[model samples]
Target: MTATQDIMNSETLMGLLAGWGITPPLIEHPPLHSCEDADRLLLNRPGTRLKNLFLRDNYGRRHALLLTRSDKQVDLKALSRYVGWSRLGFASADRLRRYLGVEPGHVSMLALVNDREQEVELWLDQELQTGNDFHCHPLRNTATVLLSKTDLQAFTDHTGHTPLWLPVPAS
Candidate 1:
């Protein structure tokens, strides 16, 4: 079977985690309209959550999976220099679809499933690993998946994508 057959959508991501012997609390809510909605929904929750950004370099030859704290303000210039790329900017919806095989508003590492051929590089904030819990879109923006930090690291490792650790200092 082709790898495309194994694309990780919401249900599939949950099943994949289950198959991996992980059973962390999975919270399912209505489709969130924005990051603010997710924050509000997860209010009073225990553990850290994140905002995942899909970016493209000026040349469009380089794509980055930037995962950081939900409240952190992205310093584009600093991030670009660290990644050794120029003019890094949010990728368009079409680019997200063409490269990550995911529609806009639903970008997540799960989308990386479609990039089995190594089309994009993953960049995770070093701070993320300091927390035991992390949350992200479950292949859809309307919902979020809460899992242990360790499980997320394991999942990323399993994907064979070497995540570049980027530390964003507090402003």
Candidate 2:
């Protein structure tokens, strides 16, 4: 929330992507806050979608965006062990704004673009590496973007973010 930056919403996200020459197909729709909402809104356009979680470490010093398929369940203990974090828990709306610049039900990997401090690390499910039809909100829940993994990689690289690929098992 800087003076020059007027809230890192989808418009800002689109501009940033354009600067990087990354054009992700935008699918405009009603605001979708949950996986079920997304599933209902964007029917027949599913492949590898994401559920971005704004998380903090046990002590609340470290933060991360845990991006996994909307279907996969998480085991915090295993995830903590994998990432060497003592424990993992959801961060609050205030913390999300402080770090990733988004609110609850609006958590998306693209929000990482606003993390200029590089404080929120990106943790992605390894299964995402095997998909081409990737969809995610562009910092806003009202719209979604279907982009190639290469473009997503480019965006991540442009943001100086190298995701920690993890194996998120099903529950």
Candidate 3:
């Protein structure tokens, strides 16, 4: 799995979801590298749009996938304190590929499928728990997948990564 070729792609991700009986709706669009792109292209799409961050502790000993509403601004310093981690920072592109198996722009909770070792921890903004459904990239920036709360939970269970739900401080 060292080569980029080993990373899961959109089709593979969709197949995995289907195998789990979790067939969520997928919408294809131009590649999106930022939340603004998502806002401009998916403005009318239903569900809670999300911003996924792949971060690591200062020492790079731990990794986490933080998910929050796209509009919310997260205070990383406050988040570090809340999670009991030394100053958190965005992980490097190499680290992102090594751990989550996706490049920077393609990160999403669904990428947990690549973490067979269960190394990356999942963290969800408590505020988002109220949403009925959420939108995520299906391991590619060119598409979006709409998943219900139940479907998300099932996906996490299948991946053996239980998310830590917490109130992420907004900057």
Candidate 4:
């Protein structure tokens, strides 16, 4: 398959995780487009729910996938200054599909598997590095997978993307 054709979907991601002997807990739910949706549907699920943002520089020459606590209010202006990026803004759905191989609502750290060219930078909230569990989409918003920090690190290492851990600025 061509590189683009090789982009992972939910099944592929699950298979990859299985191959790595890492089977995280999966919870099926209605598609979640926002934190509110998740909160309403994912009742009683254990983990620190995540919010993933696909962002781009003003010129669109650089892209980043930022992962943080779902409840944190992120200030884009302060985040830009903190990261030393040039006026970061939400990337378009087209860019998200092209780089992360996921739709806007399906954005997740696992989608970094599709970034084979390493074109999209990975930014992680340092607060999430605590040994707590994390809730994430397995390439689709229809379900959530509960992963530990070790599982996430193994997946990241497999994908060859090094995450820049930093403090996410709250609004």
Candidate 5:
């Protein structure tokens, strides 16, 4: 069995947590190479886990860091209208890296710190707030951080980014 202790030593996830004075168990697994893998990983874990999506509107005038349930299907139209954007789509991995300073598989909210300019607007699903803890990448794919929702909010606030909480309609 891969122990949490083993995973905690990883440079990317653990290093970030240590920098933030935030300590959380590191869950190691087969590389979570995609959103589908992330969803499956969350199923076996006990707390709330999010699927982070990086997007830019068609005009390149707006950027967003969208947080949704691992299983929730995002409706870009609803997102665009709610955010008062005319059209929005996922940004390319290269664009995400250029803007957030994170690679394709490691795109995470934590990467916002690297984005000192705050180019991407942070958005969270209402459901995610209900949980005591939410798992997110610490700027890497090899591990994930399971920290309190309050901590995450505090981090966002400290970063000087206003997060938009949007509730998805019943499917």
Candidate 6:
């Protein structure tokens, strides 16, 4: 596969993660285009499902992936203060594809693997990792993956990203 194809292909991503020893059980589902859609679809699946916010800094020069629980309402103002982003806004689709190799709803920790430039900062909500189990898209939204938080952390470590834990205030 070409470099771009390798980055964007979900099956390729699955193989790539498996090589890294992240062998989570894959659960297939219909396309989830919104938070409500995901919640409804993955209802029976237990564990901490994250709300990943792909954002751009005030200058649009920096990118960050903020992962918090599905229920928590992220205080973007507070998050910006913690991450040192003077301001934050949703990143464009082009930027998302360029940096993460995934579209908006398809984002997950898996995309960290494609950040060859290491330009994306990962901001994790501290409380979300309380349990050992977690849920995330495997670089695609049509499926869900159940795995250990440690395994996800391992993937991040392997990708050379040390997630910055932000003390996300409770809802």
| Top of the candidates by lDDT | 3
How high is the lDDT of residue 34 in model 3?
85
> How far out, in Å, is residue 31 in model 1?
1.6
* Model 3, span 1-171: residue lDDT tens: 345446777798899899999999888889998899866774578888899999999999999999999888899999999989999999999998898888989988999988888999999999998995788889888888899999999999999999999899999
Clashing pairs for model 2 are none
TM-score, predicted candidate 5 vs. hidden true structure: 0.82
Leading candidate by TM-score: 3
Q: Residue 163: error of model 6 in Å? A: 0.8
In model 1, the Cα lDDT at residue 29 comes to 70
Q: Write the per-residue lDDT of candidate 2 for residues 1-171, one digit (tens) a residue.
A: 354655677887798798899887888788888888867765557557787878899999999898887887888778888788878888988998878777777878888888876888888898888887577888888788887888878988988888888897565
Q: What is the C-alpha lDDT of each candidate?
A: 0.74, 0.81, 0.89, 0.87, 0.73, 0.80
What's the CA RMSD for each of the models? 2.8, 1.9, 1.7, 1.8, 6.9, 2.5
Preferred candidate (lDDT higher): 1 or 2: 2
Write candidate 6's Cα lDDT for 1-171 as tens digits. 125544747788788778888898888889876578976764577676778889898898999898888778877777777767778788999888888888888888788878977989898888875765677888888888886877877888888888888897553
Question: Which prediction has more favorable TM-score, 1 or 4?
Answer: 4
Q: Could you give candidate 1's per-residue lDDT for residues 20-56 as a string of tens digits?
A: 7666676667776557876677555666767778899
TM-score to true structure, per model: 0.85, 0.91, 0.94, 0.93, 0.82, 0.90
Query: Which sequence of candidate numbers ranks them by TM-score, best first?
Result: 3, 4, 2, 6, 1, 5
The weakest ten consecutive residues by lDDT in model 2 span 1-10
- Which 10 consecutive residues of model 3 have the lowest summed lDDT? 1-10
Arrange candidates, best lDDT first: 3, 4, 2, 6, 1, 5
